[model samples]
Target: MANLIFPSDFEWGAATAAYQIEGAAAEDGKGKSIWDTFTHQKGNILNNDTGDIACDHYHRYQEDIALMKEIGLDTYRFSISWPRVLPAGKGKVNQKGIDFYKRLVNQLLEAGIKPAATLYHWDLPEQLQLKGGWENRDTIYYFQEYAELMYSELGDLVPRWITHNEPFVVSMVGNLFGEHAPGYQDYNKALQVAHNLLVSHGLAVDSFRESGIKGEIGITLNLNHVYAKTDSKEDQQAKDYCDAFNNRWFLDPVFKAKYPTKLLALYQDKFGGFEIETGDMEIISREIDFLGINYYSRAVVEYAEDELLKHKTIKPEQAIYTAMNWEVYPDGLRDLLIRLNKEYTDKEIFITENGAAFADQLAADGQVHDQPRVDYLREHFKAAYQAIEAGVPLAGYYVWSLLDNFEWAFGYSKRFGIIHVDYQNQQQRTLKDSAKMFKQVIADNGLTD
Candidate 1:
């Protein structure tokens, strides 16, 4: 078999969120975030684990960047903690917080690794949440202000900026499902939150252009292809609705400047609809330089009369499963990429987040024999190569994480990093076999069969 080669300019890297890795939670006059509040509450996160000292990256970023250099990464994608910078989410800059990110960016540059910064990754400042959070339109401007601050401070150092990471997850999981921070159990609220997030994203794009920053700006969405469980019309309809809910609900607004008509009608009829201010859609549809996608698995759905979306996802027993219980469907990435290219905007695409978790342990030789993770990444890389072959302008790939820090609601139960972190032993970092494989892939820019 021929070797799967990527474009010569293809970028390779890894990603991590601030709250998940940079644990100096309350140090340096940083304000509390929703995650901080949620994690502290009992019966919220698994194992009662919190991100209080996750990976201790705040004090160990130098070491982490050294690891990134050792991995031969072309770039490193990390998020900024909202509360870390703006203690009240809008007013009064925390110089310490701003200084910390400056240090991190400078170090990445020194290591010859380009830095990609994500403005938001679900860590809303607790102070803002108290004021109705994203449900209130005022939060949109606050976010824009925050965006401007980041741009003015570090825009010259970081060339790539992602406005938000997975707004769907931020709205649906955090609001509707009540699994994440600022937990609320109302679909109506979730819809409002989602709309506000898009508005804020648009405002951020506007700010970026206005600031005359030379960096590229985009949003990272968690997108997956939806499949019908059967040939029945009911299943097909369910698939369409699921697609609208998961993919098009966000995609259409950013790319086409409109919501899916059917879903919009259903939402209006069922929940009285969210308020779409005049010109909001136009703002949300601002032209972006690229589209960042986080593809992990596919969705297979069947119709259900009593279901909320009138659909229910069905898991196939024949599929391989990740530790997160997500199916390992590499072909879904290829199909999703092709579909996005044929249907969505013509912007250059990047896999901003893609990786899986498995139950692997350190062996006697002080090496982690994570063969499953190695295989998982290899198959996904092949799928990405196939997407590029199909004329998709795939420009880069960033693994889900560079360290096994905090895993959110599931806490530290799920490990999604190539480098294992020994939390019990002062967060000792050890590169698993998968990391070794990735280093080679980055060096070769391809994989051999």
Candidate 2:
């Protein structure tokens, strides 16, 4: 049994997205999403794995909720599929989509769990992608419309709403880097996508307020607290480049009504300063209720001085890495939370997504042995505990995943889930050691050595 240890109100939960979990790919008026198309394409995903039947969560949500209850979760964070809502990404709302979410929301509420809703979680409608996706200004209006529709429907039940989940990733990986859906590799398009996403965020936030919904609204950012390899000035500058690329870009607009000057200088001619009309910055600069910080690990900087690495990415020398090849550094989480609280926005921060993907399997007794994940989260949760103790206004903690669902292009190969899901049989789940450890942390209300 978990010891009653957290503060009176610290939220404990797990998160999942529609495209990653809900299988009924083309069912009940659901239109195609970018992920659907991307997964269907050969060579686009690992081993040509698709999310077509991922965990079968659509039919197994009640089972999933039951698992959440059994694990003693206090909150549940889930995303609304854009294509499922508005099949074409614009015009004519689908009742079926709302019905799916309503069922999920009702289930969460019935289980005495708070519902934290994410409006967009990287599953852009395929039709929207055909029209340039995030690069086009038109998509912003569509997103806001969708947000309004959600608030109109499920706002009464969900007390917290996340506007966009990792806009930086949607733009950087999907557009600039071409590693994700609707892949494009133009730096200019990436910049435009960033600007457009921020605008959509602004529009959505404003629209949410206008809807008179009584809830806290914010955005989630996948932050990598970068550290200089040494005290050298070049390495410091490399860290600065990494910061501007990851945190400062979206943060500046949300908190300061201005994009980071450091970043603008680096990508000026490439994207022409993320063009903004009158009052656009003001719109983007509105006060947010909180900032969701998804801290996995930090990047160590080496001064590459080359034009390519100089302004783009900070190369790390760390031998330790994730299945996604990301370095494992717990101190990075503390550094990032402290930096954001001190140097950047003073908003309430939540460790939204902090979990490691490792080679995991179900043991003979139905227990998943994910020791690396347990270690990763324990270290990071300690860092998060430090953040809260340091007066960072932290409110809650939710692990990256509830189940081992489709992990984008990496597919099922990456297991970031606290619970193991058998993709072949679409069987429900088994709690991992990490999940038990998390339960211990939650029960203790804080990290106990």
lDDT of 2 by residue, 1-449 (tens): 22224457888888888899998999999999999999888999998999888888999999999988877888889999989989999998899889999999999999988999999999999999999888888998999999999999998999999998999889989987898998888888888888888888989999888988898999998888777778888878877887778888888888888887867876785546666778888888777898987877777667776655463344465457888788888888877888889976777777777788888888888788888888888777777777777778778888988998899879889988999987755475888998888877767676666
Task: Write down the TM-score of every candidate.
Answer: 0.99, 0.95
**TM-score of model 1 relative to the true fold?**
0.99
Q: Among these predicted structures, which one has the highest lDDT?
A: 1
lDDT of 1 by residue, 152-256 (tens): 999999999999999999999999999999889998999999999999999999999999989899999999999999999999999999999999999999999
RMSD of 2: 2.2
- Alpha-carbon error at 364 in model 1, in Å? 1.2
Assess the local accuracy of residue 134 in candidate 2 as a C-alpha lDDT between 0 and 100: 86
